[model samples]
Target: MSQPVYRYYAGASRTSRSRSAAWSALRWSGSLAVALYLSWLALFPYPSLSGAAADWLGGPIHRALGFAAYIIPLVLISALWRTFKEGRAAGGVIMAAASLASLISGAGVLAVSTHPFGVSPASWGGMLGSWLGEGLATALGGFGAFIACAAVFLLTLQVVLGLRLSVAAAWIAAVAADDFQKWRRSRQELATRMAGAPKGDDAVKDAAPAPAPAPEPVNVIAEKAPSGKGKRQPSRDGGPMPAASKRPGKYALPPLDLLKAPSGAGNTGKPQESEIKSAILALEQTFEDFKIEARVTGYAPGPVITRYEVTPAPGVKVSAFTALEKDIARALKAKGIRIIAPIPGKDAVGIEIPNARPALVVLREVLEGPALPPDAPLLSFAVGLSASGEPLSADLQKMPHLLVAGATNSGKSVFIHSLILSILYRARPDEVKFLLIDPKRLELTFYEGIPHLFDPIVPAEKVTVVTNPKEAASSLSNLVKIMESRYQRFQLYGVRNIDGYNKEADKR
Candidate 1:
């Protein structure tokens, strides 16, 4: 599964860019108000806008306004800084230029009002010459003054806010980057653990070595007993005639030694093969009246135990055999044994005995088995061994999604890896995509090149790996957006599922 990435927004319509723009506007507006108020207080003692008051306060007020004008560019630069920090380089530059323009305009107004001497007097020349010089000079001078002030103000503001913003941004980036790295590391570690874990069936298969080739078929003669009192009759081939005969079931039990209990803490040593064969035969004889099949599947030598697999004949309900569990257990003469009736989807039953020599169930063998269907459900998972040493396969379709929990090295990671491999083998890249969430990093790194992977095994760009649960929840909500979009597309096409919609698109 891949982790989802979340974007913070006030509403769906407010993109990160839009929010930054709004923040810039607010900062500018606030700074402008503060600057204007300070200018007004410095320029005018009274609140009145009368001519006298304008004359008295105009010069000071103009300089104050000019000072305040710097705020526009300061706000703009600050906004730009923020946007740049967020990787919006173009937006920041545009905002900075706009702020600079406001500063220039403010300077023009301030110079004319406060520095009247800078321009030639009206009496110095002809009416047109004096008019042009005074008007042009005042305008130009004021503009220059405002620009200079704005530059100074911008510099000061940058020093203060720049450090803070930069530090904060760096910390955030480092933390986010570390979080992503940790997740990748954890996923890789998990994969390694799973690859090495032992399988259950392996234990059973390792128990008994292959028996020596069977002896050649031999001829045998049976002596017939006297019927009540008559002497037994002989067959024409010179063989003895049997007094009584009976036919056994289709399947025959292997030797009893193959069914002995595993040797370990309880058992003094490995039980002889003869001991296992005799026990199984005796157990079978006890159930002779019923139609049941029992065979030793595995042995563990250290504890000298054996595992027995049992199955009921066709048309025999599992309930019919379950009733004899206690009886069969008693007959086996073992302290404990488990029964799995009607083994999942199979018709056969499963019975486990402690192996006298546990077998090793190789993953390679399981993967190659004919029973492993290519079209097995997508979400099915290979769990570890069952008590009987059979590979435990579980269908994830029932879970819809799984919440795996286990202590470190308890096989959870291995289980996940097996599941991922299994799913990849069964599904094509186009049919299935993974959304991996590896906050621990090591669990999923090896699958980077696997076609089914939706993104790099490691998180990048909008693909996020967050350590915080709250952030993870936010990412999930973002996924909800994706799901919604998909659903909407489905609705437009009158399709109820992803497959249907995809098929419809393909037709076009």
Candidate 2:
């Protein structure tokens, strides 16, 4: 009984497969019949060849295409071939394309081929072709009409062949370019290897061992590393470094490799899961101790701070959170906390605290990031990371004056270095001038005598760092004179700013 049941199921499966096959066959045969009917009509337009169907269908095609009507049947047949090959529900698509191609071919042939009105249908194209051809011929001259027709013909062929000529051309070009590059690289390698090889006579002479030179004297000096709470590991990968240009007077920007990449170890700026849960528990307990009813609904982790959103129970005043800011900081054991009574555009109160893993941003990371515009001026510099870990950059053109002040070991020197380096990466010696006065020599001292420094009251040969108080005063005095002269020039030109002065000077 089980064997009969298995046999019955197999028979049912076969029956279903046969039904699917029959349906597919019916669809394809139906499309094929349409194609054949079109072909017969276009090929044989007389009633004697295909009864009344030829006169009905072929008459219009013949009148439009003249002798070229014969080609219409072949075009339709070719278009339907794809439908049969694909065996998809796209037979209508093929027929539509075939009909379009026939019309376009008639128009194109008429555009190039000239024929008189009321002449034989086989002369050029019939009345339809002559009308379109005359219009094209009058609008564009003889050569233009021919070019248009030829282009249209090629486009129609691609459509009928189910090919995008542009895509196929691009693919072919890419393949050719890849092959050419491979060949050129191989040739270069071969030439380099040949150049490195010793010639027949020199090979023997080079085989002999030479005397070793005396060891050079060595001096090792240890330096103190930057003092920070946590030691940072060196980055694994720096940006790509290009060979520095050697052209004089045309100062190429320094290579990107000079700046350090961000470290990969532990500076994610996000607190651990246990830390967050503990903080939230402490926050609720602290409120409970203060006779306040509030709960942390959600939290947003960022590079420097994590903001916890607190939704108070009904009738719990927002001022309650403000008063407990310092107490909550002590309870959570955080360095500090900022309380926003209600977050902007939201109903919940915001309590922001420092994260455990604070991120250390590098100039290299921001310079390579998308936040900075490509065409920013030389003075445009990376401003470091935002609260949400996004890199920030600023343009100095927008703010001509800036002040950098921080406690010792709080990144003031680092900020100065980043600004100088970012400028060095973009500006040339001739483009912009700088007036740097670093009293401590910790910053701006290293930029001595490499051009881009405005001439001071000192001798041209002695364009070095100004450490002495008197020399610094002289430099500042000279800078003031330069600024006054520039303002005078701006006044003479009836301009207000340096940019306006330059434009006026250029016009003069």
Candidate 3:
């Protein structure tokens, strides 16, 4: 049976994606163009386009651009107004100011005595500012009216932006009063000190103290270590002396290379360049068959999957291609396909197809590749390899807990062993402890006595495994008690969790 499926990237719906794109385009193109045109009008009241192309195309382009100028301000005002209504005070103030200017100028208050920009005032900006300026000049006589209107605009800006001027005014008045009082008091103190000054020679003699002798410097030298024979100490077992002791240091991490290497470990036959090209062609063909417009932009081959990135044409919903997963899979002669519509933080959709020859990510290979940060917590472990073959690791401390469940023979036991081994390679025994509970005794029998255990503190073959249901329940009950104890300690210290508790304990 053919299956058609579509998974929305990061749970974002189509409407949200469209809105985000629209807002971004409008903010960048619309707002910027308007701002620039307005600036040009203010700077050069009369400017001309001079060139052959200008002579041919400039007239029509100029008219179109003039329409754009009016449209840009209107769009900006609408956007700003919407943002302000959404509880953004700054947007409100910006919208109010822009509207005021546009209104006054557009009302025909400022008639262009001369075309400053070599274009008619019928274009877009400067209408409001000119009109407001003319009305103020007629009423209050230029400068007086300009100053009054400026103050009114400033007040309007403050009110629209939700700034309380009363608080600011009061604060300024209080600061001035305090400063005046302090200055007066300081002047009085200065007058008093001048009146009480002693005669010059007597004051100087009294103020000066007798000169003292300088102390002698002491010689210092670095301490020399006791001389020893340049011979290695014999090991306690009477073998040739070991280079380093096996005993764990106070802050020592478990060494790397403790995990086993993969067997038959030659390179897995990943898809060839020809296979990739065919796959891309297959995708394009499938889309064409479905009457959908899409082009495969790129692909990243991962351990078990290859992700093909697809960029759709304008006005095409990514969801359309996503819904054709099964059809595309059939066309490519693949078992199945999965589609990610409009991948997060990217302007493209992703189609993930399973690799023909999947590569296995070995635990040791990841650890040996790069040194983990020295301060990484004991709980950090390699999860797997990412799509681009980068080692992916995760911190169990951040997770705090985990639950692994799967069908029989699903490599669950191997995964658990890898987790335990990863922890053993990083954490010292004193730093972390593990409580292993196994109802199906076969799985955890291998990890019976690895130093990091709590119940089976001393290693013994028969004592560690919990085979019965009752035994497993008892172990779990004890774990609950331990969890409660930890909670009490966390509460006492006013900390949030184990991480917080550990940080506080470390500080002490």
Best by lDDT: 2
- Cand. 3 Cα-lDDT: 0.61
- The lDDT values for all models are 0.52, 0.71, 0.61
Which TM-score value belongs to model 2?
Answer: 0.46
Name the regions of candidate 3 deviating beyond 4 angstroms. 1-258, 262-269, 370-372, 406-411, 456-463
Q: Where in model 2 is the C-alpha error above 4 Å?
A: 1-249, 292-298, 309-319, 340-349, 459-461, 503-508
For model 1 the TM-score comes to: 0.33
Residue-wise C-alpha lDDT for candidate 1, range 263-338, written one tens digit per residue? 3343343456797677668666755756555444443332323445555554557776678777777776656666
Error of 1 at 266 (Å): 27
On TM-score, who's better, 2 or 3? 3
Candidate 1 ranges with C-alpha deviation above 4 Å: 1-276, 282-336, 341-350, 371-411, 426-431, 439-470
lDDT of 2 by residue, 143-235 (tens): 666576667666766666677889889999999999999999999999999899898978857965564563332221122235421112222
Better of 1 and 2 by TM-score: 2
How far residue 144's Cα lies from its native spot in candidate 3, in Å, is 84
User: Each prediction's TM-score against the native?
Assistant: 0.33, 0.46, 0.47
Higher-scoring candidate on lDDT, 1 or 2: 2
Query: Cα deviation of 479 in candidate 2 (Å)?
Result: 1.0
